[model samples]
Structure formats: structure tokens, C-alpha cells
Target: MAVSLTGTRISVVALPWFVLVTTGSATRTGLVAFCEMAPYVVVKAFTGPLVDRIGPRAVSWTTDLASATAAAAVPLLHVLDLLTFPLLLVLVAVIGAARGPGDLAKEVMVPEAAEHGRVPLERATGLSGVVERLASTVGLAAGGALVTLLGPLTGLAVNAGCFALGSVLVGLALPRGTGRAAEDPAAAPAERSGYWRRFGEGLAFLRGDPLLLTVIVMLGVTNFLDAAFASVLVPVWARESGHGPTAIGLAGSVMGAAAVGGSLIAAAVAHRLRRRLVVLAGFLLVGAPRFLILAADAPLGAVLAVFAVGGFGAGFVNPVLGAVLVERVPRRMLGRVNALGDSLSWAGIPLGGLVAGAAVAAAGLVPILLACGTAYFLATNLAGLRPEWREMDRTRGRDAVKRRAPA
Candidate 1:
């Protein structure tokens, strides 16, 4: 989780600044980001079974180390006068590819860690959410300062270091035999089945499950909307409102801090919360008003406060989703399911910048922001009222008791 938060913070947060600095073009900056996320979504979709077959812990460490290497190479190449746009694209793409597995590995680890320690998945998931939110808060603030004080390269350097630290932590911290033992012994023979067949099994399971499918779809839609919000809103607000990059960074930090606070609160009371309603209400709160607030272009203080509130709602989101995913899938299939869900959930990310750029060009920023916000708000709330959502809502109260029963 630490690795995910920090690594993503640098890659997503600072990489844009790096591109802008080097190229002086928002379109080019967005393109660099597009390069990273596009491959990431593609690789993650297929890598699920591989993650299940091997183990998330091993994948996490190895990929994180690789990410560190890839990220570090950018600056090193720049220093060597070899940092052409093509080279930067390739390196960033590699970093994005590595990040796919790295993120899934970390997410997969959450359930394992909870199960191994006999912790409630909801509480554990909340903690993981807190870790991510906290990292974003710190990383955004730090990335901003790092970029401002020492340039974008320094921020990238810091990102590499964070990945290195995260790799070390995951590699050393997990139990020695945990990764291997988590694999299904009976599946050793099936592992030799064609890769496509194995991949089909994962897909088949998702197809068979109604609740999981519903959640996946909801998240995917939300993610696409979020992509629009994140990619377009910040830059527009920064440019139009006279907030500059520093304010942009600070806004992210405020959101992260609010999210962290929400996660901590959720962790404390997670046992009592209904998983579906909590998630639904969070989505409602997070999606619409915040975007409208941004679109309104209020005073700086109001913008920050609005984002902070939005972040709080977002903080409530991940833990519930994580707990649901962890509980729904068997440990053996966790990696594949996690990767699959994540891929769908995040598939909208690349489109975020691209769509945002086009939207801004075509419709101008304010109207687009309002449209995105309205779409997110309506989509999430309407989805929450679905029959499938009721299943999760009904289960949470009774399941919490059963979950806490003695082994």
C-alpha cells in the first residue's frame, strides 16, 4: 500500500509537471500520461492469472523494484543528455506497465495480510485506504515542493526512492512461506493448462457472480468520470483561478488529508457500517457537488474546503470496495480477480487526460467540468439504487457478526 501510494503519487502527480517543464505543452504533458496508463490497463487485464499463479507478494516486490529502476532511468537519461521524447515515452510506458502489477500485488496483499493476522477485512481494508490517502496527501505536497524547489527531476528521484523503500518493505515484511502456500495445490496441474484457458477461468468466475459484476461496472463508470475530473479540473482551475501549480498541489494534499481522515474514521467504525450503503453514500457525496464546486470557481479557501470534503467521501470509498472484493473471492483467485476488477475500474484513466483535453478544446473548461460532475453524481447515485446493491447492503449487518466469530 505504501509503495502504491508513493509510487503513484510520483508517477501520476509529478510526471505531468516533468512533461510540462520539458515540453511546455499541456497536450504533450497529457500524452505522456496517456502513454503510461494505456499499457497499464492492458497488461493488468491479462496478468491476473499470472498473479494468482505466482503470488502477489513476489510480484509486488519485483515490480516495485522494476518501477524504481524505470523511474530512475528517466532522470539519469536526462542527465546524460539522452532524454529524447521517444526515450521518455518508452521509459514512462515501462514504468506504467510495472505499476500495473505492482498495484495489483499490493492490493492482493491486503486480504492476505488480514486473513493471516485474523484481522477483519473491512478494518484492514480501511487501514490500507488510509495508507493510500495519507501517501497522496504527503506525496502531492512533497511532489509540489520537490518540483518547485529542485525541479521535476528531483520529484522523480524521490519517487524512485519511495519505490525502492516500498519494494524492500514488501519483500522482507511478508511471511516467508505465505506467498507459495496461498496457491491452490490442486491447481498445479491446471497451471499448465493453456494461459488463455486459465485466464478464461478468472473471467468465468466474474461472469458467474452478479454482485461482483455490478460493482465492477459501477466502479468502471465512476473511474471514467473520475478521469475526467482529475485530468481536466485541476489544470483548468490552476490556469483560470490563478492558483498556479503550487495551489494545485496543495489542493491535492488537502483532498488526500481529508481522505486519510475519512479512512481512519471508517476504520474505527467499519464493523458497524453497512458495506453497500456506506459505499453508495460515499459515492454520492464524492461525485457531484465537488465537481460543481470546482466549476463554480469560488474563492481559494472554498475550493480547498470543497476538495477536502470530496476527499473525505473518497476516503470512505476504497475500504468498502476492498473489503467486498476480498470477501467475495477465494484467496487462490484473489490476485486474478483483483487484477481484473482493478483493470476495469482503472480503464478510464488514460481517457481522462485525453478526454479532458478534447473537452476543454471543444466546450471550454467550465461547462465541461459541470457536465462531468453532473454525470458522475447521477451515475453513482442511480446505480446505488439497483437491486444488486441491496444484496451487499443486507449482508453487511449480519456478516459483520459472523466475520468476527472465533475460529
Candidate 2:
């Protein structure tokens, strides 16, 4: 997961610059981004049932190989002077389409992996979060340096290499029976069910669970806000502040580094903490402040400080969420349920860049920043007050009962 995500982060950091430098148009950059993410979300939404049916391991390896091929073609075509804007968009779309299921396949394997390794779900998920943050830090920093010193294409080449390596690892490193749906006898019969029927089952389960629904909705909004911050707001701020791409890399690396530390702490101690308090505190720290700080136009040091705090808070959230998700959803429904949930949470991402670009053009940076911050603050804090949030703490009791029960 970390290796694949690192490749993705590198591509994300480099792609906009590649488009902008080549076409000299911000609109084209946004267009390319939209082409990638729109297909990603849409494809992922429908692929969940397929993942459950065909098995995550096969889907993961195959789709990763596809992504690697598409990614490699970009630089290769560009070097041969055969790349056109339309061709680039098509290739980007291909990558997005392949990545959608590829990512979901990998995600649905986490719980199974944790069980196989005899690790607590929360601690395993926290370790997963740490790997993600570390990957993001390294990838973003490397991308920035590569783009500055070599060219954006170098980053793209590296991204292709990462995807290839990830595919190879997934194919060869995992145990033979790992990630196969039939490994779970309870879920095996469902593999014979039609895709739509299985998808409907997953949907019915999700719809019946208020806590899961609430979590999904809250994350949807927050993910949108975060997407806007990373894809649009941060780049604009860097340019406006005369800090350049290096500063963007610096800010992201600092935030990611802090997040790594926070995830480590969560893995070590979160099992002993109250879920409600930890979740609420984490959300409060994670949301709004980064936007507000940037709007305030504080010194670079102050901005970095706020981001560090935010990153730390952000780290606690995913591990808790992941554990909650695994507990609430049955193993048979995990793929479809996780796909639906994640796709919904990520639905606004494609529009984030487009919306931010339009809003900035009309209303300027500070107002947009303040508006996003206000929205983020309200969404996260207000959601915590809902009754469904009680579910966050229920898992421990349920687990204890199961452990004490006869096999």
C-alpha cells in the first residue's frame, strides 16, 4: 500500500506542473486532473462487488500492472514527440480507471492481513496510516526535488517504476491463499451470487447502519475540504506567497512527518483511550485550522506549526475509522461496503480543484480559505454530537464478549 501510494503521490505532485509547463494553461491542468479523478471515483464505486467476487489479490495485481503500463506510456510518448493533449488525458483516464479497483482491492485486504498476523485491528490500521504518511512525505519531497532539478517527466518515470514494483510485490510476496475470498468459508457462497445482488446486499447493510452512514457523510465533506486544500489552495498559496514548489514540499513533509509520529503514538496507546474523546479531539485538531492559518497569512514558521498540529490530529482519525469499519461490516461485505463508503467519501475530490479554481478567480484566496475553514469546522465538530457516534466505543465490549464466547 505504501509503495503504491508513494507512486501516486509523486504523480500527483508532478502532473499539474507537467500540464501547466507544457500547455501554459491552468484550465488544462484542471481538466487533466478531472479526467483522472472522475473516472477513478466512478469506476471504484462499481468495482466493489467485482472485487468481492473475483478476489482482491488478482484484481490488485492485474490493475496495478495496467496502471504501470499507462503511466510509463506518458513519458515514453512524450519523449518520442507522439504525445498530444488528448492522448495525455486518455492515458491519465486509464491510470485512474485501473487505480480505482487496484486501491480498493488493497484496502479490503487490511483486516484479513491483521487477522492473519494476529495483530489488533486498531494497531494494524495505525501502522498502515504511518506507512501512508511516511510514503507521502518521501514521495512529495522526492517529486519536488526531481521536478525542480530534472523535470516533471522524471517523476512520472519514477511513478511508473513504483507501480511496476508494487505489482510485482503483490503478486509474489503474499502467501498463496491471502486475499482470496474463498479463504473465508462464510463468504465463499456469496462469491457465486450475481454482482448486483451482492452489491445490493452491501448497500442494504450500509443503509441500515446509522453510525456507518454518519461516518461516511462526515468523511465525504471533510475529504472534499482536504482535497481542495491539497490540490488547489496549497499550490495557489505557495505561488502567491513567493515560496515556490520547494515550500509546498517543505510544508507537506513537515505535516506528514508529524502525522507519522501521531500514528505511532495512536498504535501504541489508542486501545486504552476512550474512542469518543480521541475521535472528537482528533477531528477538532485536524479540521479547519490549516485553512484558517493560511488565510491569516501567518509567518511560514506559524503556518508550519499549525499544519504539524493538524497532521498529528489527522493521524488518529484513520486508524479509529478503519477499526470501526472492520468491526461494523461483515467480512463477506467488506469489499463492496468499503468501496461504496470510500467512493462516496472521495466523490467530491475531482470537483475540488475545479471549484477552488473558480472560487479563487471570483472571490480571491482569503475569503475562500475562510469559507472552507468554517465549513470544515462545522462539519466535523457538529457531526460528533450525533447519537451514532456512540458506536465508536461499542467495539471493545463486543470484541470482549466474542473472545469470552465458546468457539
Candidate 3:
């Protein structure tokens, strides 16, 4: 999982620079990003039931192999001077489409893995977050250096290699029956259901749960904002500030390193913390400030400090959310529900780069940063005040009691 994610992060770190340098157009860069993520969300949304029906393990390995092929083709074509802008978009889109299911399949495996390993769900998810942060730190650092020194294509090639390795691991390393659905009498009825029926079941579950709905909505907005920051805003800052790709690597590495520390701490103690407080504080620290700080043209030291602190705060969020999700949803419905929930939360991401690019082209970087920061602040803070948010904390207590109750 870490290897696969690292590959993805490397591409993510390098792709914007690749497009920006190749085309010398921010809009084109945004368009390329949009091409990739739009299909990813859409394909993942529809593939959830398929993952459940066929089993996540098979889906995971297959899609990783597909992703590896598509990612590898980009550099191979570029080397032959056969890669046009349109061709590049198409290849990226393929990678995104394959990645969507691959990512979802892996996520579905986590709860089962946690159970098999006898770890708490929160701790397992926290460890997952740590893996992601560590990957991001290493991948982004490597990507920045590769792009700055060797060029972006090297990063893409490494991404392909990682995907290949990930496919092999998933196919060979996991215990047999690891990702198979658990034996439950109720699961027979679900297995008999058609794809659309299963999808509807997942949607109905989400519609009835106000807390889950709220989390999805809040995350959708925040993810959109984050997408913009990663794809357009940060790269633009690096370019305009004369900090170059190395500086981008440094900033991201610092943030990711701090996030790793935070995730480790959360893995150890998050179960004892108030979910609402942790989530709200995490959002408060994670959102807006980095954008605002960058827009203000603060000293590099101050900017790095804000990013590190924000990243630390950001680390607490996913573990709490993941545990709550596992508690609320049944194992049989995990693939579908997680698919629907994640798809909804990520829905806004497709447009994030496109909008940021256009906005920056017209209104300039500082304005876009300031505006996005404000939107992020309102989305996180104002939304937290919603009555449904009380459900977050309540669910944790109820789950604890359920765990402690006599069998």
C-alpha cells in the first residue's frame, strides 16, 4: 500500500511541473489534472459494487497492473517523441481510471486486515495514515529532485515501477481468503442482489446517516480545496517565488514529516480523545492557513512552520473518521459504502485544478489563495457547528460501550 501510494504521490508532485514546463501554460496543466481525477472519481463510484461482487483482492491486483501499464506508457511515448498534449491527457486519464478502483480495493482490505492482525480499527487506520504521510514525504522529495535534476519523466517511470511492485505484493503476499467477505447469514441476501440493487443499498445507508452525510460533504469541499493547493496553487507559488521544484519538495516534505509524527501519536492515543474535538481542531489547523501564509509572502521559515503544524493537525483526522466509519458500517457493505462515501467526498476534486487555474489566470495567485483559504475556513468551522456533528462524538462512546458489552 505504501509503495503504491508513493508512486501516485510522485506522479502528483511531478505532473504539474511536467505540464507547466512542457506547455508553459497553467490552464493546460489544470486541464491535464482535471482529465485524470474526473474519471477517477466517476469510475470509482460505479465500480464499488463490482469490487464487492468480485472481491477486493482481485480487483486490487488487476487494477494495479493496469495502472502500471498506463503509467509506464507515458514516459515510453515521451522518449519516442510521440507524446502530444492530447495523448498525455488520455494516458493520464487511463491511470486515473485504473487508480480509482485500485485505491478503493485497498481501502476495503484495511478493516479485514485490522481484524486479522488483532489491532484496533483506529490504530490500523492511523498506521495507514502514517504510511501515506511517509510516502508523501519521500515521494514528493524524490519527485522534486528528479524533476529539478533529471526531469519529470523519471518520476513517472518510477511511478510505473512502484505500481508493478504493488501489484505483485497484493497478488502474492496476502494470506489466502484475506479479502473474502466474512461468513454472515445476512451476506447471502446481499450476494444475491444485483449491482444496481447493491449500489442503491449503499446510497440508502448514506442518506439515512446524517453524520456520514455531513462528513462526506465537509470532506468533499476540503478535498477540493486541497486538490487545488497541491495541483495548482503550490506549484504556482514555487514558480513565482523563484523557489523552484526543490522548494516545493522541501515544503511538502516538512509537512508530510510532521504529519507522520502526528499519525503515530494518533495511532497510540486517538481512541482516548474526543472525536469531535480532534476532528475540529485538525480541520482548524489543516485548513486555510497555509494558503493565507503563502499569499502573505511570509518568510520561508514561517511558511514552513505553518505547513508543519497544519500537517500535524491534519494527521488526527483520518484515524478518527476511519474508526467511526468501520463502527457505523457493516463489513458486508464496506466496499459499496466506502466507495459511495469516498466518491462523494472526492467529487469536488475533479474541478479543483481547473477552477484554480482559471481563477489564477484571471484574478492572479494571491487573490485565489485568499479566496480559497476563506472558503476552507468557512467550510470547516461553520460546518462543524451543525447539529449533526454531535453524532461524531456520540458514535464513539456508543461504539466503546458495544465493544465492552458482554458477548
The collision pairs in model 2 are none
Best by TM-score: 3
RMSD of each: 2.6, 2.2, 1.9
Screening candidate 3 with a backbone cut-off below 3 angstroms (N, C-alpha, C), the clashing residue pairs are none
Candidate 3 local Cα displacement, residue 220, angstroms? 0.9
| lDDT of candidates 1 onward, in order | 0.77, 0.85, 0.89
lDDT, model 1, position 266? 88
> Best to worst by lDDT, what's the order?
3, 2, 1
With candidate 1 superimposed using the best TM-score fit, by how many Å does residue 311's alpha carbon deviate from the native? 1.4
* Model 1 Cα lDDT, one tens digit per residue, 50-110: 8776777788889889989998998899999999998898998898899898788777777
Q: What is the per-residue lDDT of model 2 for residues 282-382, given as tens digits with 9 covering 90 to 100?
A: 98997889999999999999998998998899889888888888777777678999999989888887777778767876788899999999999999888
Consecutive 10-residue window with the lowest summed lDDT within model 3: 398-407
- TM-score versus the correct structure, for each prediction: 0.93, 0.94, 0.96
Q: Best lDDT goes to which candidate?
A: 3
Alpha-carbon error at 307 in model 1, in Å?
1.1
